[model samples]
Target: MAVGGLDLAKYCSSYDFNSNDVKSCSRAVDLTEACNWQKQRDDLEGVYKSADLHSGICLDPKGKDVGGIDDMLGFCRQKFKRTLDVRASDADGKDWRCVMDIDKDVVCIWQYSDKSLTAVQENGLWVCRRPADAASP
Candidate 1:
C-alpha cells in the first residue's frame, strides 16, 4: 500500500505491526481488502513526525511513541559515528525539522516549499541547512 508517497517497505514486510493486518485475503475473506494497515502506517509516520516536531529542542529522546531532534542527531552521530560526517546535520536551533518521510526517505530542514531535501532510502544521504526562518521557535 502507498500513502503520502511512501511505499512503506519495512512496514509492509511484517504483519506483526502495531495495528496493521497484512492479510491479502485472497481465497476467502471479506469482500474488500482493507483494514488497519493503513492506520498503523499513519501512526508510525506520526511518531517520526513528532520527533521532527521537537527536533533541536529536547536533548533526550521523546516519548516511546515520539522523539525529539537531538535523538535523531545522536543516532547519526553515535550509531553511525564512523559515517557521521556523511550523514545529515542541523544547527542548534528551532524551526529545523528532520523526519523519516513517508517513503522512509530522510527529510531534513529545508525550505517551506513542498520540495524539501529528501534522500533516497537505498542510496545517498540527506543533509540540509536551517531554513531562513527556521532559526528559532
Candidate 2:
C-alpha cells in the first residue's frame, strides 16, 4: 500500500507497543533513533527548512490515532528511560521520536544515507522526494 506516494511495504514497518512482540517494539525504537540522528545532522548543516522538521515524525496506520508527535515522543522517552535508567541523562538529552497519522493504515519509518532524498510536508502530510523533484514548481 502507498500513502503520499510512498510505497509503505517497501520502506516501512509497523509496531504495537502494547503487543507482546518485543522485537518489533525494539525495531521501532531503533528506527526512531536513526531518524532523530538524521534530523540533527540536517539541522546542524541548515539543510532543510524548519517546516520540514515535522517529517521526522514516524508514520502510523490510519485510524490508529496514536496521538500526536508529543505523545509518541513521550512513549519513546519512557521506553528509553526504562532501559537507560543509569544514563537517564542521555535518554532525555536526545530528542524523542514521534508519529504522524496518514491515509490508510500503514507505518513507515526509514533511514536514508542518500542526501538526495528529502522529506517535505505538504497539505499537512509528509512526502518524500528527490532533490530535483522537490525543486520543481
Q: Which candidate tops lDDT?
A: 2
Q: Judge candidate 1 at residue 85 and give its lDDT.
A: 36
| TM-score: model 1 vs. ground truth | 0.19
Which stretches in model 1 have alpha-carbon errors above 4 Å? 1-69, 89-137
- After superposition on all C-alphas, the RMSD of every candidate to the true structure, in Å, is 20.1, 18.9
| Backbone clash count for every predicted candidate, in the order shown | 1, 1
Model 1 agreement with the true structure over 1-137: per-residue lDDT tens digits = 11133323434323211221222101111101111122222222222243443422221223333322333443333333333232223333332212221223332222222343342323333233333443332
Candidate 2 to truth, TM:
0.22
What is candidate 2's lDDT per residue for 1-137, written digit by digit as tens? Answer: 11234444333233323221211223233434333343432222111113344333432333222222333454455444433211111222233232222332222224333334555556756565555443322
Model 1 CA lDDT for position 19: 20
